[model samples]
Target chain A: MEPELATPFRERAGRALDDRFLQEALTVATTKFITLRREAFAELPEGDALRDQARAIKEATLQRLDYWLERLIERIESRGGHVHYATSADEARRVVLDIARRTGARMAVKSKSMATEEIHLNDALQAAGVTPVETDLGEYIIQLAHERPSHIIAPAIHKTKGQVAELFARELGRETEPDPEVLTRIARAELRQKFLDADLGISGANFAVAETGTVVLVTNEGNGRMVTSLPRVHVAVMGVEKVIPSMTDLAVFLAILAKSATGQKLSVYTSLVNGPRRGGEPEGPEELHLVLLDNGRVRQIAGPLREALNCLRCGACLNVCPVYRQIGGHAYGYTYPGPIGILLTAMLNGPAAVKDLAHASSLCGACMDACPVRIDIPKMLIELRREVDQQGIAPWPERAVFGAFAWLLQRPRLYRLSARLGRLLQRPFVRGGRIRWLPGLFGEWTRTRDLPAVARRTFHERWAALEREARR
Target chain B: MTTKAEFFDRIRAEMARTPGRAPSALAARPVRPREGLDVLRRELSERWRENLDRFQHELERVGGVLHRVAEAGEVPDVVAQIAAERGMHRVVTWPRDTLGVDVAAPLVTRGFDAAVMPGTEVAAAERARLRGLAAAADLGVTGAEVAIAETGTLVVVSGAGRPRSTSLLPACHVAVFERDVLVESLVQMGLVLEAWHEGAEPSWRGAAINFITGPSRTADIELTLTRGVHGPKEVHAVFVERGLSVARRA
Candidate 1:
């Protein structure tokens, strides 16, 4: 389930910044991830070319998304598998519920899937009287804690080993030492039974090959293999944009995904499922279903955020994002978080949902550099800000300040007159060369940071002065 | 309750509206993947020693153990040594024809409980019983379909004799492969995948293909890396100098 969205983005971010443990964890995790990614790319000679090729593959696939999806459906059905199309999150939930009910599945084991998180499937499953157990260790921890994931890959990074030990003690009734190794052992023993007993397995597709009808899952733990293999019924939910052209294109993406995410040459396990079990196979699911989800993704195809569809959900952008590094994921108050999350939140919900989130970034372009596909995140963010302002969704005071500023900039005489007047108006607030406090709406900016007072002589005035000296 | 046609129609409508998208093309697929793979294999075979050296360096880098043997016949001894060091007795393995080695009989002679998976399909009840055996086993032995050098990855395809759990489930997984299975990069692996899916798949091909890079690991708990969270704690790759006599899948 998602956290409370009632809290505005600033209050949420402020609360996150106040949490001492979260601040330390975010700094350590993001710094470590950034360093690892840098070293990984330094070793790969063909990384740049692969990134471009991967981006192109995503664009090409989106241009013919309908054709690729049709082919994917045809191939999956031909392979003795089922394909479900979900136009909305509610529809996707219903489709999954119907499968669980028909299959008589009381419990479903899941690999870590952002798509399921995006749809908030766990709550729906619980409401349907079927237990959905998250098998990924990070996801399992958060699920047990009755909280949402704070990070995309490292979901429980916000929680210390001490908290996890306490969680296990309270939930699993196992009192253990605060040690990752011991805790992981306990989780393994506990979840192993769930994998063997669960009648249904649900996963998300990292990449679905349209040419071969293969759903690829990348995970460090082998839970993905366990879930897909042990369960009688297997369901994979994928965003419509995840489909690719061929295995060759998959290779291009694979070459760079892990490097950007965790700096590993490859994740520990990359499982490719070509539908349900074939004849003579000793162990595998009897039925396979691929759920194609288009929850607000279709609108973005022609929308301003079209390039964002190329995201691999690697979370590389999050690690490099200054805002995300400071406030962490929970503050974003959305399933997706970070610079990419702001765009994704807008994509999923609406421009109104991200009116505040759109201003979260400083537009430093670190996210663009860290992105595996090199998505122009800052550029699209600027566009989203424009859309939010144009739609009249932005707060009136924010609009008034920016709108007044824009109006003043267009008229040279008014601008110069205001510049002279601004110096007089700022006299009271300016103390020791900075405006440490302000009144009204502008006070929010100075609450945490000191703003430099307007220059003694503006750049335009300085240029004019220089021209006069040259003439003399 | 959205139908497939309706879902596709919406996608098509959106796509039609985005006419000014920059012209782009997908990564160029192999024109003739089968021939391309064959040529690449031949090239790799000559420099397999270098590939194996690189594979060992990377495998060790990622916390995987690698052992080298002079011939395929010496593999069981290596497996025995690994088992002895770990004080493990129960072992599960893929069938002899699939693994290109007959380690079950050799292990049984040495007083180890070695269970070999069936080469043909069994009843559902029997399948459940075999799964129980795999789950209880201490060590799992299998054959590698493709040994990727670039990332030190072992690609295993599930099939009739090759149960996926033999390389999973167990605490330690040991895969035996010859030089023939070696590929230099993910690019070559891509070509191999294309070749495998060129035409009609074989009847015995299972539903899943797994690429195991190292022991199952997670860094989720406060970013502290922990091994064998859900799968093998240790993964070993034994390279055979003289290739196995089994029929290799193209």
Candidate 2:
């Protein structure tokens, strides 16, 4: 759950690859998501233009974020909802804890919120004496197992039903069968009580509409509705970049969000909460708080990774990514994990944090195509790689190798001499037109992949010989 | 903690650094959403039947059941039949004034324990009791504010007699609506939302407006689709062809 940070990224990815069950699960889930999204987009004639409009809206909002956020605060306050600004993850945790402390909250039920996971809110809530309950089925499973979500949308995809059955039997003392239907029924009965009893409901906003002072939550399991409606107090934590202009803008986003996520036209429930309970409402939360989080997003407004701010967190990018398909989300070792995750990790934690992750993608550009907002993830990743190199965060061996290659490329004579020398040095290693392995530190590269053998005659030498023959 | 002023100041500082990143603009909003909605609704009225057909097609495609009736009086019978099929005895619903039909009396006559939500705010103890009833009930019937035909969505706004849990807490949820509530697409739904927030909000309107596309579902367990994880498993929409007497929003 703490990101398994002790292990290196390559080792983590190796572990995932060796796991037969995880391999099967990842392949099945991601492939299904890919097919569903393709079918969804294929049906909608206006999807491409909507994607462009959504991206433009995100960029335009960032340009005037201060104005829009000010308007949002005014509208929310007018409707009796409170807004809190947190500059860092620690401050965000404190803000939520203070609200919980002041409101006399004991039990808190949560919908699936990646922002909360990023801030590590569950530990804080527990340390402060309030019991935090994850109500989403996938989230609840992982929470009980003391694990983090493997996928954004499907958190428990890595666990087979038998594993979940064992988890539930151990955690809840309910001896349930391994059938998904039975396991789901048990979860429904178990979480229904928590939804009713919990005094606090915390969620992550998919998008916050500034003009209407509305917090829109799109969910398929309907937990978002329950969390916002049942609890006496509701708190929504969101990144500062999620604030959109108006309901019209929200429509454009909604059109593609679920389609990109799971290929549903709309997630089962999209709850737009203006504030808390109104005067004559029969049932609703009495108080609402929106915590605007700026973990590391403000700097990216002018930074190289700014395009990543446009990400919708749809996980469509994850499904289509070849690297993610092989390694899975847990291997990335962060709150977000995929092609976009590399950029987002850099955005939240700095480029130095993702020295290896920046190179995780093959730069095939499938993620950009799958993104609802069309965030050029590969472009940002390339920039992140450059930033890492510029910051001297790359390993010394990698830097030295690239530096030597660049130096050689600059001098044609030196490059030719090196190629000729390589022909003599590589005689021991070259076999059947491939270098199976190399000696010393370079052997690490050949361990997982083969290197092409240096030619007997270089391309420049061949071209020079051809020129001489033509002249004759 | 960052104050609002400081947060904005940081953002403004970043904006100053990037002057010509790109010349971009936000989506153009409806200049006069109220007028725009009026004209759009008038145009859509002529094709209301087509929209209804589309709505039903989409709704059924998403695993929601659609029931058509000749009049408002026929809704109770459909509700009763659905309850019988499920062997559900207890029912909760919006009050007659909000639902535009007297389901409680008829459901009771048909030997079901029916409880209608109160129109006015009640004491905390009574609120808890009603919530318990809703949680314990097998069926929940409510009125939809708008139904989008394009996505098979029933939009319900929580208000005076309309509790959010009526459509959420029960295993089986039945929503009754008329032709007036049907819209063609999400864009039209957006216009309706704009118009609702254009002026002072209606005093009775609550905090949440939910768009229910289908029954609550999840594919978290090895990508196996499961329904009613935390909400209703079955969602049925009863359309009254003769329309109800309730005032429709223009």
Colliding pairs, model 1: none
Candidate 1 structure quality by residue, lDDT tens digits, A1-472: 3555878788899899999999999999999999999999999999999998898899999988888988888889999999999999999999999999999999999999999999999999999999999999999999999998888888987999999999999999999999999999999999999999999999998999999999999999999999989999999999999999899999999999999999998999999999898899999999999999999999999999999999999999999999999999999999999999999999999899899999999999999999999999999999999999999999999999999999998999999988889888999999999999999878889998999998899989999999999999
User: Considering just chain B, what TM-score does every model have?
Assistant: 0.98, 0.96
Evaluate residue A220 in candidate 2 and report its C-alpha lDDT on the 0 to 100 scale.
Answer: 92
Chain B TM-score, model 1, reads 0.98
| Complex DockQ per candidate | 0.88, 0.83
In candidate 2, chain A reaches a TM of 0.97
What tens digits encode model 2's per-residue C-alpha lDDT throughout A1-472? 3557889888999999999999999899999999999999999999999998898899899888888888898999999999999999999999999999999999999999999999999999999999999989999999999998888888888999999999999999999889999999999999999999999999999999999999999999999999999999999999989999899989889999999999999999999999989988878899999999999988988888788888888999999999999998899999899998888888888888899988898999999889998888888888888888989999989999998899999999999999999999999998899999998899998998889998988899999999999999
Residue pairs clashing in model 2 are none
Best by lDDT: 1
Instruction: Please give the lDDT score at residue B110 for candidate 2.
Output: 90
